[model samples]
Target chain A: MDKYILGKYVPLNTFIHRLDPRMKILSMILLMVAIFMPFPSWTFTFVMSGFNALIIFVLMLISKVRLRDIIIQLRSIWFLLLVLMIINIFLPPNGSIHIIAQSGNFKLYAESFMQTGKVMLRLIEMFGVAMILTATTSPQELTFGFGWFIKPLKKIKFPVEEVSMTVSIALRFIPTLIEETNRIYKAQSSRGVDFKHGNLKMKFKGLIALIIPLFVSAFTMSDDLAFALEARGYNPKAERTSYRVLKWSTKDTIWIILITLFAAGIITISAMHLDLLRHFFPKIW
Target chain B: MQIEFKNLYFNYNNNSEFKVTVLKNINYLINKNNITAIVGKTGSGKSTLTELINYFLKPTSGQVITDGFISENSTKLKFKVVNKLRKKIGYLFQFSENQLFEDTVIKDVSFGVKNFYPKDDGYEQKSKEALRLVGLDESFDSRSPFDLSGGEKKRVAIAGVIAYKPDLLILDEPTAGLDAQGKKEIMDLFKKIHETGVQIILITHDMNVVLEYADEMIVLDNGSIQKYGSPKEILKENVEKYNLETPHIYKTINALKEKGIVLNNVTDIPSLVTELKKHG
Candidate 1:
């Protein structure tokens, strides 16, 4: 199994890894908001691109993780990229006069192509930022961040700690579960169950043989885990002291300020519709 | 019934880069109604040997020929044949927790029986009888299997298999991670079950259990049979040869042997105790 594809966060003492998960999560949300807020003639796009490049460079240098490794993680979604491109080329645009090309009965419009490029770039940027956050943060840190983020919901008696623990365990076991699924799949295949050779219906039914054993193993593991947890007297409601404190230092503050400013700059540029920037920039459309 | 493995070889993941050869060119026989103990160092193909007998794994080469069915020669094992074999051959997993999947203890025990005999009116009755045989009360039938203690869970797992009335019972490390009392209870339960004419095969690392209960023992090393003989003969002669420890009672016998205190019929604790009293 490709470890990176399953979000198995490689531990390293990199700058991105050092930043608090709460800050990383907040930055991810701000970046997504900036992407969707619209840009003025792709100038904001260049600014965001430079920002993403800076983060990626710092992460790669600090974490000592290869750039090729991150690319491998992104490769799983190559089909999604192709689908987005196809949808963009065929989608009808409102008030579009220019036809880029015609194939068979389909007319490719200019505006739709431009929109598709913007959407694809946005998708890449969003997921790229998300990958950085998840790959750098440990499951414990993420769970703690969840608890801190959802502190306001405590007034409603929401089981925030319990939910965070559940999320953490689920994230921790995803790789294990995937490995188990692969084992079971291989076992069934050895039994002369040709999963790949069958028609759609046959393939679907063949999946049953795999699913039943996987589910059986999962339920059994859950039972053992529950027993282990109970034996340790794990109380979700107990007040606990954390080993790692999430504190905001000068470097952390600077990182947050820079990210916030870049987000604000994108929004401001988009809202103002600055014509000088538009004229100077290349037409990404 | 006899199961003979002739030059059987098995690898868990045969095609992958990380393939592990668990059992290698193994040849052995499990005779009918005999209590055979399979002993080996960790990962010495003990569990794999038992799994091969029930066709849980297909041998890479050679054949495993049981009385009525021949697994190695068969092209594919049908569900009917597998289910039929399973009904007569019960396998108790090392971690008994994996064996209990139903809501309550009784339901978990009855799962195998219900699956094998869905329409039988005596299914529940048989489940209760199996539980009682394992020294579990009828009231435990409604208790959640998850809520039971480790020893209780093991008993329930045993009851689950016994409810199917299997002729051959194979246990994988049945006394693992249990207290002395828990271990004694489990060994006693095995004795009771064996007395009912079920052939028993125990895979274990504990030498004490082998001395106490097993009639025949086989030592496995690196996927091959190191030695196979009766417990007393294996312990008295070849245990140290395989770099295996003899049981404490046998160790005492060895100490007495150095002092020229020869005693006959000193295999078990009771006989040893009687011999010591005579010497005094």
Candidate 2:
């Protein structure tokens, strides 16, 4: 089983990896808000791009995660890019003659191209920031951060400990579940169940045979887990203590402040519609 | 409970062209309250035989009867009876980590017990006692099982089965990758558990464990029973014929025999050590 999917936290002593997870999570949200702020002018997009590029460059240096590795994670969302591009081609135009028609009415429209480019860029920025956040934060740190963030909800009688426990278990089992599914697939295939040699409907029905056993095994595992938990004398009502504490340092505060300022600037510029900001922006190509 | 397989023959996916005939005409009787070690190389139907005892795989022909209940040849017996029979037998996997899925060690260990005895009143207490038996402290109950070491994880898995309090315990390679200290701890735990009167059937290739713990040993070869007798008798007579190596003590005795050093039977390490003292 490859342990890479649960963020693969390499535990480097770099600045970004050492940053408090709570601040890093807050910064991630801020980055997303900055990227999505509505803007008719292209300047905000250029500024957002510059900010994202700086983040990627700094994160790569701190985490030492190869650009190729991050790009591999992006490949999973390729279908979303295709869908956005198709939607862009049919979207209503804004009186711009951006379409270039070539022989026999085959045309490439500027509005569609620009819309697709903007959507793709935004998607990449959102996912890239998320990937960076996860790569730098260990599973324990992320769970503790979640627990800390939700601590205040205890006043409202929320089950924060239970919620965090569930989240941590889910995170831990994601790789295990993937391995189980692969094993079940191979086991069935070995017993003369060909998963790929059938028509659409036949293949769909065949998948049930695979899925049923997997579900059965998962239920068995869950039942076992419940028993193990009870045997360990776990009390859901008792207050839980963590082994690792989430400490917010000076560097974390600086990171949070910088991200907040960057987000505020983007929102303020978009609101004001400044002419100087509009001229320096690059047109969507 | 006595487990007996009479002329059992099994082939997986029998109707297909790629069918694998795993076992054929196997005959064996595992006596109750005694440790039986099944030794075989890979693909010798050892796993298949154990699986048959649990009814995980039914024989194509012949019968697997255990504790006066027919487990595999259930055409004559009802399904409910077979289920009742299986509830008495606990099967431990080779890779113990794969069986652990609970968030905490206690919960993972109590999984089998909860399944078998759902209506029991003191389930929680039983679970705690099982964990204690496995040498895990109470402080570890609430901790995430993912944080546990490999040997600890294996112990937790064993604790799960132990909590069920089954009549028969079947373990497949329980000490595969443990260090010397870990192996001793686990083997001693097994010995303590066995002394409490539960029948233990272990499948292993470790001759040292077989010599130390097993009363009877069965050697499997190419889906057939190659040898079956008391461990001492088999080790004394035909250790070389079966291509199975004896323990170091047995090899030393044999070496001494070639050198005209006459000694009474030295079957185990301790006995050999005592005999060497006589010469000194």
Candidate 3:
């Protein structure tokens, strides 16, 4: 149950952990935009992904986030990766300029590898970007960061603060719900729910037994949490004051400058079709 | 059942960066025929120890032996043995009312009985008897447990547990979150069940309940047992030093002693009053 690391925050005082939450959010967006930059050439896409992966790798090292945790989070997208590979293998999207393997009418194309690798790497890059943001920044910081970003929307009656609070509260509930599910599973299993060896019908019965009670508990907990929020003076559509006044430091300005330049470099390189690896290794390309 | 813990150590997540040892190395053999109370502050691994006994949790090291059945970290316990062990010991978890899911109270109460005795035709009768013992009447049998009050739902959940007639009952904060009246009723219900030859081991924060009901007490602090003895014997010691406030009756006794009126064995109000009357 603890294996998941998608929205879980690890409390470690590191360089990445110390960065302003707003800066982290901004950096993640810049990197994601760079990874998905408009580059039609397969080689360029792969090169861009490599750069994004390198950035993510550095973040992981600095944040001391474990690879195993990231890989476990990445497992969710493995099936889509597999499906992309399977589809691309039979029907190459990049063109069958170089035939890698052929059996009867079935043929493997080198270009298929290009397309699959491009997509697979981008998926991993994006997942890594999100993971880095969530793992380093606690939900409270993330909520405040998000609110900082959307503060302008409050002028248009967007309920910006409420949205941020809802998002952070939802993120917080993920682990609580997981723990609740585990407890319910243990409680039911002890009552002889035979989930392991039960037949299909028996398993269905066991699932119903679990689901109803879990819903009840979840609802009960949500009510309690709502009451707690109310007791703490959380009101929707009310003028709220900031509890944590986190101001951006010089470090945040430096991060912004670096990320803007990186974004510009990605756009320039993609527009110029300057994929140096493909340019040097013509035959390999 | 002869329960023994042999140097048991438990971590919720072992072999991980987030590893936290919940139970430390300790060994104790529970005297089989006592109403044992395991009391500790929150996060002191009180619930973990009870879970270990029920085989719901496997220790990270050493072994937990209940009766002749043994659960070890390195080995897989057979389902037959696990099922047998679980049936012989009914566990009433904290917020047990949340475990209720049946459409009606009777079916919910009979859940455990049905599980352990699917072949027995008298499971419904057993459920009714259990409900009666918990002070819920026949009208409650048809009502949805979820529709009932919180205290009633708890009673229904407890009834489900005792319907199976386990050799031992393990309660984790059975009376927690209840009103004084509700707490008294539930504790008295356990006493009635205990008289039926079922040994009870409860994890509770209620020192008064421990003094009034428990025959043996284990004081756990930071995953280690600091004292193991009868309630009177252990509660007489410096309990506050172990992250526990002294029970109110004990505080009263001490205050009277300071006023030159020392009382012995006066751990409860009734006993203190009786002792005071006798002294006069």
Candidate 4:
């Protein structure tokens, strides 16, 4: 369970890794918005989502994160995507524009198939976007970037510093907590607590044994941490120094320019679509 | 029951980049009816070795033939097979008290019994019997396991495993984190349990525990065995070469021998006192 690298930050020296985390965070938000831009034309929406999927793949490669690793990470969510596509393809609640296959009461539509493809592409792009952002940006960087991005919210007493500290601390303890849980799980399993072999009630009852210990340990750990922080004269409201401050470099500016151009292209294409792809590629069609 | 490891090789996260071999080419036959100790430094695959016997971890390439069940990476060790193995072999993890979860001592102790044999109606009886064996009486039964002293909580955890009455018990650092009194009591409890004819496999860093309790010992330096023989043989021969800690008793005996007062190797302080009186 600890070996799952999908959401983990992989430290690598790459072009994307060196980009300002705040810029990366900003681009992530922008790209996510672009992915779900809700264009009036379905063709433009479908095609643009496909294009975004390609962009994610290219970005992953450029960031030095292996395509294979990303695909392996995506495999865990493949079932959900499959279920969605299957329902969209075979059990669409409404009429089909082009019914390609039909049984007595069931029909398969080309339009619904296209719709399923669109859904799959959108989901894949979103997952990819998250993967790229997390894999490139370290947890510390992400926390700092998030805090910086939401700094304006502090004007309304939103406690951005506490939020960032909480994020950083949580990220730090994930590994430690994972190791503890594994130990408890193995210990319980040795005593014949089969977590995999039980009804919901039975499983929950079995889990109570582990949950109590985990809660106790977590409280103990947090208490110690708080004690240590206090002993060291740490304060949330007091301004703290950073070890690695985020700087807006020329690379960050170049990424912003690229993001602007991409956004502009998407806006322009979404504004004017009528049989666009086939119109451009009649021979291929 | 017999455990035979034939060319056993084990690794962690085999499909991931973090994959590293933990145990390599382990071959041994563990005959029944005696306590066998596995002594090794931290990360020397001591716990991992015990984990294999319990089928908590399986070998990458070789067979772990325990009580006639074979585990290897080439074939999937089925759940039913592993469940049967677990029933026959009880494992006491280090700091086992952390596993206590039930509100009452009896409930906590009976957790394993009830978990494995839900159909059995006499789990409370077995749990009570286990608690008695571990030196906890009926007075402590209804109290919350959480509120118990450290030693009492550890016993409750030990009782959880003992309630099932496993034929083979595997203890990983059973004496860890206990006071001297708690340690002796817990060790004595194991001795009493051992007298009942259940074979035991102990993983301990304390050489005194091995010298006093273990009939045979496997001195592990890394993933490989430095010496696999009686504790006496290992202590006499390769122990110093492997840099294993000489037990306090062994150190005292050695110091006496240097003063030209040679005596029989007594494992514990009480035995050494008796041996000294006999010679005097």
Worst 10 residues of 1 chain A by lDDT: A185-194
Error of 1 at B160 (Å): 1.3
Between candidates 1 and 4, which one is better according to lDDT? 4
Per-model lDDT: 0.75, 0.74, 0.85, 0.83
* Docking class for candidate 1: incorrect
* lDDT tens digits by residue: candidate 1, A1-285: 554433556666677888887888888788777767754444455565556556655645665545565567558777877787677676765656578888899888876766666666666656566667777888878888877899799889988777877998887788788877765554333222446664786567457756765787788788999999999998888977777778767887888899899888767867876644546664842
Give one digit per residue, the lDDT tens place, for model 3 in B6-49: 99999987986779988899799985777999998999999999
Ranking by DockQ: 4, 3, 1, 2
Q: Model 3: runs farther than 4 Å from truth?
A: A37-48, A110-114, A194-197, A221-235, A278-285, B16-18, B76-81, B115-122, B245-256, B259-280
Separate DockQ for every predicted complex: 0.07, 0.03, 0.61, 0.66
Which candidate has the top score in DockQ? 4
Docking category of candidate 2: incorrect
Residue pairs in collision within model 2: A98-A110, A227-B107, A228-B106, A228-B107, A228-B108, A229-B107, A232-B106
lDDT tens readout by residue for model 3, A31-52: 8888887575665666667777
Tens-digit lDDT string for candidate 2 (A1-285): 222432665556677888999998888888888777766645456566667667766767676655666567667778988888887676634654666654565566766666667777777677667777887888778888878889999999999889999889878876678778765553333222345654676466447645764665677678898899999999988877778777888888887898898888878877876644546643732
Native-to-model Cα distance after best TM-score fit, residue B155 in candidate 3, in Å: 0.5
For every model shown, the clashing-pair count is 0, 7, 0, 0
Docking class of 3: medium
| lDDT string, candidate 1, B165-224, tens digits | 888888888999999988998899899899999999999888888988999998888888
Error of 3 at B186 (Å): 1.2
